[model samples]
Target: MRETVYIFLKAPVAGRVKTRLGAVVGMGRAAALFRIMTDWTIAEAQKGSWETVLAVDPPAAAHKRARFWPPRFRRVAQGPGDLGARMARIFRTAPPGPVVIIGADAPGLRARHLREAFKRLRGADAVFGPAADGGFWLIGLARRRAAPDLFDSVRWSSEHTLADTLKTLPESFDVRMLETLRDVDEAADLETAMFRGRR
Candidate 1:
C-alpha cells in the first residue's frame, strides 16, 4: 500500500516557532534551534521508504516561495483549524493508503520509529506513539476505510490529549500503541533530549 508521512511545521521565523522553549532561550536562539531540529527531523524521516509531505502552518502559499525548506518533498498548507481539525483533515484528504503524521519538534524520532508505526498499522485501524508528557508524538491510520472524527473535543497540548482522542474513536476500532518518545516543548525537554544525545 502507498504510504505518506506528513511533518507538521510552522515557518521557521523568530517569535513564531518554539515559543515555549523561547521562554528559557532567547526567541531568536529558539527559532534557530528549531530550524536545526526541523532539518534533522525531516532528514531522519525521509530515510524511510515512504513519500514525505510537509504540512506547513500559516498557509502554504506564504511559505511556498520561501527557501527555508528543501525542494525535495511535496508541500501543503494546513488550512484553518485547531490541531485536531488540521490533523483530521490530513487523514481525510490524503490518498488511499496508510498515513502517518508527526510534529517537527520531536528530535528523538527516527526512521525506525516511523517504520514501526507503519508496520503496526497493518493490523490496527489506528496507531499512536505515546509521548512522555501524556500527549502523542505520532498518529497513524491504516486508511482501509474512511478516517473517523477522532480529534473532536480533545484537549490538545494537555496531558489528557491522547486519552481524549482515543475516547472519540469507535469502540470496535483496533488501536495500537508505540514506544514513548519526548517532544521538545520547553527548556527542560530540550535539556533532556540533549542529555539523551537524541538532538
Candidate 2:
C-alpha cells in the first residue's frame, strides 16, 4: 500500500516555536533548538520507504519561498483549525493509503519507528507511539475504513492527551501501540534528551 508520513512543524521563528522551552532557554535559543530538531526529524523520517511531506504551520505561502526546507520533499500548509481538525483533514484528503503523522520535536524519532508503524497498520485500524509524558509522539491510520472521529474531546497538551484520544475511538477499532518515546517540550524534557544522548 502507498504510505505517507506527515511531519507537523511550525516555522522556526523566535518567540513562536517551542515557546515553553523558550520561556526557559530564551526565545532565540529555543527557536534554534527547534530548527535543529526539525531538521533532524525530517532527515531521519525521510529514510523510511514512505513519502515524507512537511505539514507546515503559518501556511505554505509564508514558507513557500523560504530556502530552509529541502526541495525533494513536498510542502503543504496546515490551514486553519485545531490540531485534530488539521490532522483529520490530512487523513481525509491524502491519497488512498495509510497515513502517519508526527511532531517535529521528538529527537528520538527514527526511520525504524516509522517503518514499524506502517507494518502495524497492515492489520490494525490505527497505531500510536505513546510518549513518555502521556501524550503520543506518533499516530497512524490504516484508512481501510473511513477515518473515525478519533480526536474529538482530546485534551491536547495535557497528560490525558493520548488516553482521551483513545477513548474517542470506536470500540471496534483495532488499535496498536508502539514503544514510548520522549518529546522535548520543556527544560526538563530537553535535559532528558541530552542525558540520553550521552549514554
Candidate 3:
C-alpha cells in the first residue's frame, strides 16, 4: 500500500474560515488568505510521493463539484466532530500504510516536511510537526499497531495541545518530532510568514 497525506481544510467561505485571523484582517481578506495558503499547501503535497487528499469540513463540501479547491485531488468529509475526532476518523479510515494529516493554517509547511514525516514514520510509531502556537501542524501514524486512544483528552487549541496528545499515547510508542513551524492563525503570524517569504 502507498503512503497517504490528508490536508484538512474548511471551505473558503467568508466569516466561516479563519475567524481569529478574520477578526484582525477582515473576513474577506482572511478567507482570501486561506485560499492562497490552501493552494500552496496542495501544490507542495502534490510534489510528494504519496496519495494526496483534501479532508474538507462542513461535510457537505465533499460533494460540491464547484469549490475553491482544485478538482483533480480526491476529497473526504471531515464529518461532524471536534478537530481530534475528525482527525482520528481519517487515521482509522486511511488505506493501508502510514498516514499523515496536516492543516492548511501552516503556510511555512513544505514538501520537505511531508517527506520527513513519512521518513520518520518508518522508524517511529508516530511523527509530529509542532507549531509555534502550542498546537501541532502535522501528525502521522505508522499503524503497525492499534491507536484507538491517540487523541483522547487532547486540548484542541490551547498551549497544552501537543503535551496532552503525547500523554494519550502508550508508553511503548516511539514518537518522533519534526521541526517547529508557525501556523497563521493571527495577524501577527501572517505578518511573520509574509516577511519570511520576502527574505
Candidate 4:
C-alpha cells in the first residue's frame, strides 16, 4: 500500500482566505502569505516519497483546470462540511495504507516531519503534530481498521481542540504525538517570521 499526504488549502483570495490573519495584517498581505506558505508546503511535501494530494476548499476550485494550486498533482474537492466533517471524508475515503493530512498554516513544516509521521504510524494507530495554539497541524492514521468516531465532538478552534479530538478516538488505538509547532494565524504569530524574512 502507498503512503499519502493530503494538504488542505483554500483559494488564496483576499478576504476569502486566512481571514483571521487577514484581520490583523491587511487582507491582501494575508493572502500573499497564504500563497507563499501553500507553495512552500507543496514543495516540501513533494520531497517525501509519499503521494501528494490537494484537498481544496470551495469545491468549485477543484473542478477548475487552472486554479491556484499546481496542476501536476491530484486535486479533490473537500465537499460541504465543517472542518471535522471534511477531514473525516478523507480518512474514510483514502486508499488503503497510512494517510497523513496537514494544513499550510505552519511555516516550520518540513519533509522530515511528514517522514516522522509515517514512521510513527508503523506502530501507532494515529499520530498528531500539535500546534502551539491548541489546534493540530498534522494528523495521520494507520487505517488498519475503521475509525468512525475519530472526529466526534471535536471543538474546531478552541484550546481543547486536541483534547476533544483525542476523546473521540477509541481506547484501543495507540496514538503518537509530534513536537508542537506554531501556526501563523494571528499577527503575533507572524511577527517572528517577519523578522526572520519568512517570505
Off by over 4 Å in 4: 193-199
By summed lDDT, the worst window of 10 consecutive residues in model 1 runs over 190-199
Candidate 2 ranges beyond 4 A from true positions: 61-63
Provide the global lDDT of candidate 3 against the true structure.
Answer: 0.90
Candidate 3 lDDT at 72 equals: 85
Off by over 4 Å in 1: 61-66
**TM of each candidate vs. truth:** 0.94, 0.95, 0.97, 0.96
lDDT of 3 by residue, 1-199 (tens): 7999999999999999989999998999999999988888998899977999999988888888867688888999999889999999998899999999998888888899999999999999999999888899999999998886888989888899999999888889999999998988889997776447635
Global lDDT of each candidate: 0.87, 0.87, 0.90, 0.90
Query: Model 2 over residues 81-134: C-alpha lDDT tens digits?
Result: 899888988888888899999998888888999999999999999999999989
Q: Please say which candidate is ahead in lDDT: 1 or 4.
A: 4
TM-score of 4: 0.96
Please give, for residues 1-199, the per-residue lDDT of candidate 1 as tens digits. 6899999988888999889889889899999988888898899889978999999878854357657788878888899989999999999898889999998877888899999999999889999999999899899999876546679899999999999999988888899998898888889887776337752
Better of 2 and 4 by lDDT: 4
lDDT of 4: 0.90
RMSD of 1: 1.5
- Score candidate 2 by TM-score against the native: 0.95
Clashing pairs in 3: none
Regions of model 3 farther than 4 Å from truth = none
**Lowest summed lDDT window (length 10), candidate 2:** 60-69
